[model samples]
Target: MKKIALLALLLFLAAIGLFLAVVWNGYEWHQKLTVTMDTPNGPLSASSVQQMRLSDKRGPWNPPEGSGVSFTLSGEAVVMELAPGRYLFALLTGVPSLGRLLHPKMDVIDAAKLLERGEAEAYRSVTLSRRDYPLLVTFGDMNDPASVQRVDPANLEASFGPGYRLQSMTLALTEEPVNTGRVKKVLAWIGPHPELKLSPPTGRTSNIPFSRRVGEGDFIRGKT
Candidate 1:
């Protein structure tokens, strides 16, 4: 009977140790960043943004897979900020709740390096087409217009309209702490959730106001 009790105690201690280890490795602090973009109509800012996530795990386990930040600008676009050390940027159309459609083109942006450099700039051309949906919006790299991917009409979401036009835009990032205190950090670690949570779209409202002009070129400038 004594041996059985000792064995049970050992098992309990082992379980406690494992739980502490998981909590320690899972504990992380994140900062919320706001985004602002310059458009043809005016400067448009993302209504919701996901916090930048960093994990305590090392090696291949670090950051897990497909883990990164995202910014949702209502009916405008969804920007997925991916790649850890070297960031890769992709723009999608749609909202978070309804589901976002990915754009074939992906842009690489070294945010930390750009922060040191003061700013980063890229030129792009915007195109619009008519489909079963209201409007189809497409963006291409002006530097290499020929290389732009030909997206299938079925893959696009009907979001924009005639007045919608994007010429030049600037993206700015400002970071604020999300988990600071010990109690708050522990609570955050225990009940982890997605960095950005937003409601579904209501109707065909124009969130991004763009010019009706076709084949227009735009500048994408970023600042830390």
Candidate 2:
């Protein structure tokens, strides 16, 4: 009886080990990518970054908990050994020049205060898909048509305040893939939530005719 019991225990342990191995194999496919920058500031490190995982079938993955790739940045280079899945990467620096179009009145500093005041600021997002191995990504000053349009001296000065100029930095991947269905889902989600929309203060503006009259019927009614 003792011998039989011991053998049964061993079999149970072996079954568990095999199950774990299969699960790891199914979930652990990863590839390595190298990223660099041309500016003197050097490579981006862990200090200023945000990352998200992507699903080939569903789009971006929002795990209830944390589940993503790991990377290391050295000087102007970054090496990411991410699971063989899609991912989004963002590097943080100073204010993005073209971001002015989104919130003309808000500077990065002012945006930060809005956070402190329990408000929110929206940031611009761009996506690129990479399908090849040994991938390399480069970052430097932005000169793209969209960036150029937003940063034109006249536009920036008008929107971002007098004398303000727009200077932008950007990222580029060597092997960009066409927009995948998954990327569209991710973009749809990056927009500001409805709750974040702030209503303008209730008051008269210069544009309103001084002759206009206020009426109680114009106000929203409450349930009796």
Index of the highest-lDDT prediction:
1
Question: Residue by residue across 1-224, what tens digits does model 2's lDDT show?
Answer: 99999999999999988655433222111111223222223333211121211211221433434333222121111222121231212211111222222345865334333322333233223222221111222111122111111112223333323533222223322112222222123223222232221123347666642113211111101110
**TM-score, cand. 1 vs. native:** 0.25
- List the global CA lDDT of all models: 0.27, 0.26
Best by TM-score: 1
What are the models' TM-scores?
0.25, 0.21
Evaluated at residue 75, the lDDT of candidate 2 is 14
Candidate 1 segments exceeding 4 Å error: 2-24, 51-53, 57-224
1-224 per-residue lDDT for model 1 (tens digits): 99999999999999989765543332111112223333335544332222222223333323555344333221112221111221112222221211111122332123322322333231121122222111223334323322223223343222222332222222223232222222222122212222211223335466522322211111111111
Clashes of each: 3, 3
